[model samples]
Target: MKIRKKPPQEEFVSQAVRTGGDGQDAQEIAFIDNALFHADHAEDELFGEGSERIEVADWHFISPSCLEADGPPIKTKVLTPKQEKLLFLRYNYARRRIRQAQIRGAIRGTFESLMIWRQRAQDARDALVNANMALVPAMLRRVNCPNVELEELISEGNVALLRCVDRFDVSRGFRFSTYACRAIIKAFHRLASRRATYQKHFPAQYDPQMEKCDLGDRIHRQRWQDSIEWVRDMLTDNQAKLTLVEQTVLLERFAMAREGKGMTFEQIGPIIGLSPERTRQILRTTLRKVREAFDKDTAGPVQLAGA
Candidate 1:
């Protein structure tokens, strides 16, 4: 891997000098520039062209292969113990470099270099993760989780595998697979525990029939019926200040007092001795007056009977 060189700090130094107002600003700028320069030099010395670089190729789990009775074929060339150690070393070293840069306050000036190391760390981590991808399905075969889907288990196992790659200590001389298996099983156990808790709280599977509740609907319908009765009383008592013809048009148009459905303007027109348009006009006018009266009655402050 070719490491990128850090950009010269002189550019920042010159820009700061041009914009700075006093010697204090200039001194601070120079101090920052010197720290960044040393930091860049240290990074180059550590990871530059002379260092041994490990190349990681893209690898993925072939789903069809995972179904085999024996085990899934390794997607990439299986790393030897030495290669695995090197990859882990590189990954952790890159992270340490980033942390050191952050501590030294060199990150702001070395953003590009930091990103390159981050990408290297990610690549190394991915190589380890992909090489061990088969372990997930292999472990899954031994697990019996009837409630969880195979896909969800695989997903959880993959996440656990990635986390294991980050946390495993190659120096401890333990095989990565041994460490990874425990983590993946714990992940599955946690998933199972969550599923158990969820089932405890909600024991029954979702059933549309069982979920159906009509109490709210009944209450809403009763309220609507009461409102309709109140409006009928208003029309009957002439409390809405509607004229006789207006009242007749509204009652017949809406079928409020009659048994059948409401009449259209054309049907109510002949009964009221008016054209359809005229009947529609009377209905609109009656509705507006009724709405005004209803609004006034509802909006007014209520009084106690004695008061």
Candidate 2:
């Protein structure tokens, strides 16, 4: 597949050159575009559509280095002039709003619309963001590992920051720092997981065994009876080496789970003799096999786009 760059992404970067602060005024800062492209089309766990438009949804964080006049400048990219200005404006507003709320004793209300809306919520969240410069990075860096590269962590951080922005509710008596930290950690794990060669090792080729199976969707998941067959297909050599116990585990670990995401490593670790790492490797291997079978039967040229 041809890999091409997408439209520039927007991000912030700290540069080397220092601006002379005029008396009391602060120097304006510029933002950077640090997004890494994943595919030439809309790829998910696997690339889906679009021959030209690349998908950056899987791009990771490249955390930035903060030392001055020490080592060489970290490998970094900058955003366009327009995007930089917008980022500046966004952070400025976020900081100001958080500041006003703190100073004025303005406590927001709790999240109550979750019950009424059930599924669709327009005014879902209201919360205090990491307003002061003091709290923002501390909130975002909860998951940063010193062993990991800096720029990568920051890239993951941006995605986490956005997630926190979306899910935060100030009225809940929880600080934005607390909520944002968890989100950043989750985003970091997701980005880190992408480093695994899921695509390279497991390609879902077309199949015809089950007439109408579709793997690329959240909907149309196989029934328990059909799930048995699916799990069988997932085993190496198509169940030739799969034990009865292994099949049972797959049923509960993956097939029975909603959304087909399977049990987490911690959750599934005790059930099988293997550790979580081994379980993950096995699941990844099995999933690609099943997905390939399903795609051949249902998601191939036989189905319409978005079907």
Candidate 3:
């Protein structure tokens, strides 16, 4: 069986830069460029269709730098006269609206007009973002945060880029790239700090089993404390049918009070002037009544230490 080879891509020229080509190829390139130039001006018209021509310059395989690695930075490419003029227009548009918003801060109907100007400003800023995407990778390489992925750093840099556009002062004569780079670096640091704090609370290698055991222990301790509180309240209840001697015996026998040592019947019997057997009988009867009351008041029986 014979294998079929793939055909060449419709795009012949790879990039904006020129390379050695014959007169025929140059003519073809010029024709394609002219078509695109007209297509870009058409509104709501599909490319490669009636009254529309395809865009193929950006579709080709070309390094954004469009120059030698030893040459000037890629961000410098956006500093052309046309781009500068567009940026100036966008800046002035946003500036006029900002002043208007301030003047009409107390007015109710100023919002819609302010929003329109803001949208225009954002469109202009987005153009700047697209032109300066090369700067993001360069800055991320410089930061060298091993923990963060290149994609995450790029996303953070994009956010910082938007913020920089909002705050950039064109009158200062400083390049937008310089201001945006600083903001992007700060964003990277903030993200790293947040990740560090989160890791401190919950480490990367979390264990659900350990957490489950800790939860169980906490629940058990809570139940034990509730049981102790219930017994103490029962002993102190003046309306309960328990006699005075029985209350004293319960409090002393279970260490419910600070002075209690959970004394045996023999020890408590002499203090109460009763036989040890009689004291034990009263203690058992009082505990049985308390247990019954506790079961009735709560969902389940309390776990006595030695029932």
- Candidate closest to the true structure, highest lDDT: 1
Instruction: Pick the TM-score winner.
Output: 1
Off by over 4 Å in 2: 1-149, 198-307
Candidate 1 vs candidate 3: the TM-score winner is: 1
Q: lDDT score of model 1?
A: 0.69
Q: Can you write out model 2's per-residue Cα lDDT over 1-307, one digit (the tens) per residue?
A: 9977433321100111111111211123212211212223212211124222221122232233322224234333333333322332333333332323323331222112212221111111111122212232443444544434556756567656755554444345445556666666676676656644453465564567756655744344334445544444445455334455455456557545345565666677687767878776776655554556557555222221110
User: Candidate 2, residue 24: CA error in Å?
Assistant: 41
Candidate 3 regions exceeding 4 Å error are 1-77, 85-89, 98-116, 206-307
lDDT for each residue of candidate 1 in 280-304, tens digit (9 for 90 to 100): 7887778778777777778432211
The 0-to-1 C-alpha lDDT of every candidate, in the order given, reads 0.69, 0.41, 0.58
TM-score of 2: 0.23
TM-score of candidate 3 relative to the true fold: 0.39
**Cα deviation of 214, candidate 2, in Å:** 43
> In model 1, where do residues sit more than 4 Å from their true spots?
1-57, 64-76, 106-109, 213-307
In model 1, residue pairs whose N, Cα or C atoms come closer than 3 Å (at least 3 residues apart or on different chains), thus clashing, are none
lDDT, residue 29, candidate 3: 21
Instruction: Per model, state how many residue pairs clash.
Output: 0, 18, 0
